[model samples]
Target: MLVSLAIATANQPPNIVFVLADDLGYNDVSYHGSEIQTPNLDKLAIEGVRLENYYVQQVCSPTRSQLLSGRYQIHTGLQHSYIGVAQPNCLPTEIPILPQWLKNVGYATHMVGKWHLGFYKKACLPQNRGFDSFFGYHSGSEDYYTHFRGGYGVSFDDRDHWLGYDFWDNDVPFWSAISNYSVFVFNDRVNQVIDKHNKSKPLFLYLPFQSVHSPLQVPKQYQEPYKNITNNNRRIYAGMTSCMDEAIGNVVEKLKTADLWNNTVFVFSTDNGGQILEGGNNWPLRGWKASYWEGGLRGVGFVHSDLLPSDVRGTINKQLIHVSDWLPTLVNGVAGYPLNYTNLDGFNMWDIINSNKTSPRKELLHNIDPWPYQPKDFNTNMTSAIRVGDWKLLTGTPGANNGQWIAPPGSGITPHLPLTIPGQNVWLFNITADPYEEMELSEKYPTVVKTLLAKLDTYYKDSVPVRYPDDSDQANPALHNGTWAPWE
Candidate 1:
């Protein structure tokens, strides 16, 4: 009986290890029908709950801001990607980040890989924000070989001097010539951090792997595992994904070896839906990473905790939860901490998760600024969208028609607001019945559109769009056009 009691207590309040994969698509994992053999991820899903309807912002920065702050991007002043030192980039200090909140409850917090929220010196980097230790780049993306380009540039501007390398260990310069194996290197670092933490205390580990993003390069071992696949894109993508899965397995093994597995709660997910075009498989879902479609925002999410009701194990949750829900959820459910943090649009999904309730969200919002450099026709801009239950309303150019902007009649910019004012783009949709958003019914439902549009107006008025530095285009070469932003 005592042994049984110990086993039951072992699984409660488990260490929360949140692993994020870069640009991973929905169908990339074998469990999701991908040719890739992601044993680690597959094992987690098989053993734990898999959230089928999890959602996040389309792009990286906004998603990062939402995940860390437990609020919408608009509330954090990071509605758009932080383009280098342009304007006031990165997540602002006013927002309470996940690590800070977790640390308050005596959880040792550590972040390894990709802190793309902001790139300015001293003001918005991960270490300053809340993370106790950060090992990664501070930009959007990094070159696999040269360590240049991508969303982040070749260099990072440290407070005193412009740091030559984009990599760092909490502010101290860290270098790795093994550009091709950056993900592997970061995984090692994450393991080291985990090993360093005190076993008795809870820990919040944020491992955001920069794998499968771009400049696709994978170790030969991971590649060999997927050689059976004939398609080169799928094969390579599978290899990269498999490598990350192995890394995850390694970390989980460490936890088990340390006897910390049962005490830890692990949440695994991607920043956004994977890229559909570049060997990414958002199977059965419409839209890619950048569009306001189901694939781009919906991701694979799983929460494993002994504290959850026994029925939750191996269960499937279809709740309308988003990235912003993590902070409050963890605080309320895991840490036994109280958070009076207000102005947050996310809800605690604890009750829904525990009771297996089908309580759908009354409404949700998706706002993305125009990726101007994306050959205007091939990308979206300044769109204000809302998801109410199963219906989603989009105002602005529905940048979904193969990147071609679709302007519905009477859905133009407010005449009084200047085009440069930002957040003018808008649209609406009935998402539940038509998740793909193939049909636009804004014309038929005028009153619903008007009500949602008013909500957007209030949100926009309260929030400020990320301002591009006057010299952003010139300063950031990637911003020149088309190139995906690299985390420097």
Candidate 2:
């Protein structure tokens, strides 16, 4: 039995290990009928409850910010795009974030892998944000082996910069792992953290892995399994994914070996949809990442733990879960912690996860990004979208019709086939009836579209100004001794 937070007791609350994958698509894993094999993810997901209707933002930092802040991007002024490598902004420090809350309750917090949230100031770094230890990159993406990030353009203000090492340990730059595969380095570090953890105290491990994202690089051995794949990009991407799966399997093994598995709630999710142009396929799910389509926003997620009710284990939960729900759900509902924090956009979803109760959440604000957008090529079109119950509304281009159904390599299907959906600025869909968004009904259901638009206006009125800034020359890693570190 878990101990109540009110009184310090012998029984410890369950340890939480949240693993986030970067740019993983709904169709990338074998469980979802993809050609890529994700044996470890498949095994663990089947043993746990699968989140069929799970959703996340269409990009990296927005989903991550909402996950940690327990609030929408509009609330945090991060509604535009991801935190650029040379951008001066970070997730607002005024807002209390996840690790700090868990640490306040006595969990020993450790972070490994990506920290794309923000690192413009020392206070915004992970260590200052309540993590006892931090190991990872502060930027969005980088070379897997060299640990070097390119394309900063802030390189001496030349707009083409030399690669700089981005790996770190806590607030300091780490170089020992340079040229070593990042996934392996992270996996090893996770084992060390698990092995050194004190069993009497609860643990909070947040691993936002840089797997399956880009740079399309993985160890050659992992790629051997997919040499049969004809498409070069898909083959490499498959290898990167398989490598990430192995790391997860290893972490689970480490937990069991340390006797920490029994009391651990293992949650796995993707930051957003795949980048189809970069060898990702969200077949039959609309568009790819950076779009407003279901393929971009609907995420692949699952939770595994011994704490789930036995009857619900190994079943599918169709609850309308969103990325922002983790914070309140973990604190108030699962850990039995009081609701000391308020003004949150997320709901306490623990009951829905554990007991299979109907989710208290009926509405979700997907995003209100200001930039004009279309996936295939750039064009200006507003993409403010929202969902209420069975209805979903999108203002501007949904970006679903660009080369639809880019299948995995050697699937006997040709590539670059276009979807026939016409371009429209406003679309309304009964999502429950059309999960794939096969039909747009803005004209048919004029009232519903009008109502949802009004709701969006209310949210827009409450949103903070968007904080995206030009890539600062001051953020040049060359200025920070060739490592991405806090400059301010």
Candidate 3:
């Protein structure tokens, strides 16, 4: 359907730039009522299509894998936590991925920022994983300034001991990557890629920022504006967010200068909901990152492009969009490739984003974690969440912040979403009506819960086992000459 594709300048496929923020809260942006200033993100959402009902995984690697693979975590055996530096597992290599698909259609694929998918082997690195060039870290989290990733001192220790530089130019380690904050390092590199890009070809830039994650550190100048913030984490987070906002604005300016703005489609999304304890607040939505609550999975997302029809531009879209849908959306929709050649959990969401059409996605399997005994889990899988139409069912222990709606300090908000529940597990919510997950309604909707449970079971039947492995001493920086590089 070339008619549906953007008639971008030069008649080439639209340049797609996907920017993923780490652990960004639903309400952290100032536009969402938080005190954090984010003019660039706000501008994109306000000027483009603001995704009010976006969904992503509750953690980093799961969401990244889903986005790149265009499949649910269950299909890829990444249903567990993030791919820690020492973990022997990764986002399997045999399966076709997003960048590879893009490159197949003549798009130059590039990746900058965090590569948390896996790096135990060179095959898992972004460059080998279809990227034309890669400039980022391999670990999930690291010092934004020092660029040192903390892992076990010894491979078997499992304690924070080894701290090594994590900057890379491609496959080789590049330690002298300018002694400065990562926001600047990455931003400059992204602009450089754009500056030196062949304008005739389409560009696919996957920019996963290291900002607003953890080890909260930002320049004093970025933090100076938040002097009124009493909370230490919040203040530092505010600075990191501000720096990211500025970086986005600068990137937008670079696109314009490079004459790529007219033909570019910019997509911004968070890997997951905010981490409450880490200066993030998903207010009014129950729980935080790693929980089944709306706060944890509902993401902040938007798309900006000249391709969008004028009437639909600057509008709020409540369509159901999932992270897994990016694969088909980009390949089949934006790139105008047919979908018959592929089976993907991600739908071609171009209609929902550009044409203001209803989303084809109605049912979603949030996850099906590892569980040996699954007899009582609604006759399905345990430690999971599923959405069928308006109903969302969550079962098993949801881990930290269970059923807690923690308002940020000085927020002065007293949540009324009843905290009481039948048990720690088995929660059903009509997310359409109760986005905040105020009331537990499993007892009220027995049949709906039963159907959702059955669906989870069916999905679990198709899912491969979780591939998260324990940290090995081989990942230790000590073993790699004080670096967190591949050892497999």
- Which numbered prediction scores highest in TM-score against the true structure? 3
List candidate 3 segments past 4 Å from native. Answer: 4-8, 152-155, 371-381, 416-424
CA RMSD of each candidate after superposition:
8.4, 3.6, 2.0
Rate residue 307 of model 1 by lDDT. 54
- lDDT accuracy of residue 177 in candidate 3: 70
Residue 326 lDDT (model 1): 82
Instruction: Score candidate 1 by lDDT.
Output: 0.67
Candidate 1 TM-score, true structure as reference? 0.82
Between candidates 2 and 3, name the one with more favorable TM-score.
3
Number of clashing residue pairs, candidate 2: 1
lDDT string for model 3 (1-488, tens) is: 35645444545789999999999999789889888889888988899999998899999999999999999988898887777777887889998889998898899999999989888898988899899999999886778777887763235555567777788999777777746899999998998999899987999999999988998989899999999989899989999999999999999999999988878889999999899889988887887898877888999999999887898899999999999988898888888766665557888898888877999998888888864543432342368998888989988876555668878767777765446545556889889998888767888888987888778878878877777666787777778888889998
Candidate 1 lDDT over 1-488, as tens digits, reads 22342366553344788888888887777887666788888888867778887888887777878888888876665665444533335577677788888888777888998887766547577777778888887664566544454323424342222223456677755655435477767878877887798866678899888877876667677778766666566677778888888888998888888777766778887887676545676755666677766777778778766556677788888878888888777776666577786777777766676667764467777874543442222122446567777777665553334322221112242222112224434445677776655566766887887777676666666665545443233335333232222233
Q: RMSD (Cα, Å) of candidate 2?
A: 3.6
